[model samples]
Target: MFKDRFEAGERLAERLEKMGPFEKPIVLALPRGGVPVAYRVAKRLHAPLDVIIVRKLGAPFNEEFAIGALVEGEPERIVLNEEAVYRLGVGKEYLDRVVAKEREELHRRQKMYRGEENPIEHLSGRTVILIDDGIATGYTMKAALAAIREQHPAQIVVAVPVAPPDTLSEMERLADEVVVLETPEPFWAVGAHYERFDQTSDEEVIDLLKKGKERTEE
Candidate 1:
């Protein structure tokens, strides 16, 4: 098991270096848990770091059970679990309401994390390395991939510390490459694999982003 996110990030960065010689790479993390992990990778690679804000769309009664995911954009990108919706008998009205609510939260997070800074506008022809703490159901990451695809990036690489094998398989179909440090059998929650799984605060995220920006400048 990984000691913490920073250690996990170090190990992950080591693995990524072995792959070697990426073309005009840029690191995009899934905040807020991803910022710290991505920061380590960005520092190691001397790459620019940014966040791709994606939120899970929870079920009507069970907020922990994700039915879909939404990613921030001019017109936000969404990916739904059709089987889950059909099984749960979810209606369009409910889905619409949730989308609106989640979009508002996404905007709030964008402002809090980025302030007046603009998002990276030029992703075309660059290799995008997408990072996160770990993957659970993988819906949110899928939404992130969908949003990134629209930008016409040269390659999309999804990297994380740990995830279920099945989830990694799904990611492989969407991304050009998938780099994972661990895929434990009988997988529990992402936190179960980490010794220190504290919630990442908004202020921590802001500070990390500031540091990441400075890294690129230096």
Candidate 2:
């Protein structure tokens, strides 16, 4: 288990350096847990950092268990975790309501943090690095990757500190290149590898994102 998120991110960056130069790499993190990792990456690579906003759709009663995710956009999408949703007895109507609720929250987050500014237009023929803490089901990461592919980056690299063997393999198939520092066999959960798995707030995510943007503009 890592002492904290920062340590995990540091280790991840070290592994990435061996891959190749990160010159002008756009480090994109899946907020809010991914922000801490990306912050370290941006620092180590001396590259611009940015956060891709995504909200997890939780079960009706237990809000922490993500049944899916809602990505912000026009005609916003609700990517459901079929396994979780079925386990939670989330039907189509229930799922639709959940999607709408999460979409509303997504709108609230963008308005509160990013204002009306659209994400940077993806410059084609450029490398893009996507960072997250860890992966299990990999649904959230899948959603993020799909969204990024829409932007048409020259390359997409997915990096993480730890992941299940299957989950890491899935990322390898989805991303142009996958760099997972550790793929612990018989994985249980992301929290198992984290010494301090505290919830990251919206404010912290925003602050880190602002840091990334300012660094890029410098």
Candidate 3:
């Protein structure tokens, strides 16, 4: 069992080195949770690191229930939570509203974290490694892949500390390569596997980016 996200990242870093040097690949991590893991990955690989913000569309009434996610790309893609939508009787109007709100949040985040920096480079003709702490619904990760795919990357990798067996298997269909460190059976919540699964703050995310950028620049 891993001590926490950092230790898990260290283990993942060692395994990823076998794949060879990153050379020019960019490490884009899903923010809030993925930052710590990606920090370790970027440091180990000597690759530039950045954040890719994604917003999940939760069900109406029970907002915690994820029904879909929104991501930005060359051509934006939306994968519906058809099962949840159907079962919950989530109407089109609610979805549209949620999407609009999320879009605004995404933009706000871009301005806040990124400032005047150039938008993340297109993944086309480049190796793109997508990092996340873990996956539960898989909807968020799926939407991320769809967004990345639109840019036509030469390769896409999904790297995570741990995930369910079925979720890991499903990722293969979306990414060129998947570097999963652990696929524990009878997986409980992602937090269960981590000894210190604190809610990562925005400041922590910023600190990671700074450290990662400096390391990669060198």
Candidate 4:
């Protein structure tokens, strides 16, 4: 088990550095958990850091269960879990409502975090290192990958501290390269692997981004 998200980020950074010679990769993180981990990685690699806002569209009856996911980008992307949607008897009306709500949140977050910065414009033909704290269902990351793909990145690398073995395998097929620090078995939750798993706040995320911007400006 890792000490915390910071430690996990440090260890993950070490592994990525050994992989070597990434082509000016921009680090895109899935907030609000992924920011801290990605911050460490971006600092280590001297890469530009940004957030990819993707929200899971919860089931109509049980909001805890994700039926699909929405990714924010130039043209917003929506990825549905067909089986789940069908099994749950989810209709277009429900999906439309969920999509709209999530889209608002996505735009709000983008404005709050980026504030007119055109990072998306620079993504084309650049390697992108996508970071998250860990993976459970992996739907969120999958949606993120779809959005990144729209930007036409030169390469997409998915990096995480820990994930279930099966989920890691799925991610491998989706990403050009997958770098994980651990593929723990019987993974119940991502937090179980961390000694101190505190929830990352919006303030914390903004601070990290500000710091990252300062680093890039230097």
- Top-TM-score candidate index: 1
Q: Tell me how far the alpha carbon of residue 34 in candidate 2 is from the true structure, in angstroms, after superposition.
A: 0.7
lDDT of 4 by residue, 63-142 (tens): 86778789876777888989999998999998999999988988888888888775656788899999999998888999
Cα RMSD, model 3: 1.8
Residue 79, model 3, lDDT: 80
For candidate 3, what is the TM-score?
0.92
TM-score of each: 0.97, 0.88, 0.92, 0.95
Model 2 / residue 107 / CA error / Å: 1.4
Off by over 4 Å in 1: 116-120
Candidate order by TM-score, decreasing, is 1, 4, 3, 2
Between 2 and 3, whose TM-score is larger?
A: 3
Candidate ranking under lDDT, highest first, comes to 1, 4, 3, 2
Q: Tell me how far the alpha carbon of residue 154 in candidate 2 is from the true structure, in angstroms, after superposition.
A: 0.6
| 1 against 3, candidate with superior TM-score | 1
Candidate 1: pairs in clash: none
Report, for every candidate in turn, its global Cα lDDT versus the true structure.
0.91, 0.79, 0.82, 0.89
Q: Which one wins by TM-score: 1 or 4?
A: 1
Model 2 has how many clashing residue pairs? Answer: 0
Displacement of the residue 29 alpha carbon in candidate 3, Å: 0.5
Task: Give the Cα error of residue 76 in candidate 2, in Å.
Answer: 2.6
Once fitted onto the true fold, the runs of candidate 4 whose alpha carbons sit more than 4 angstroms away are none
Report the error of model 2 at residue 162, Å: 1.4
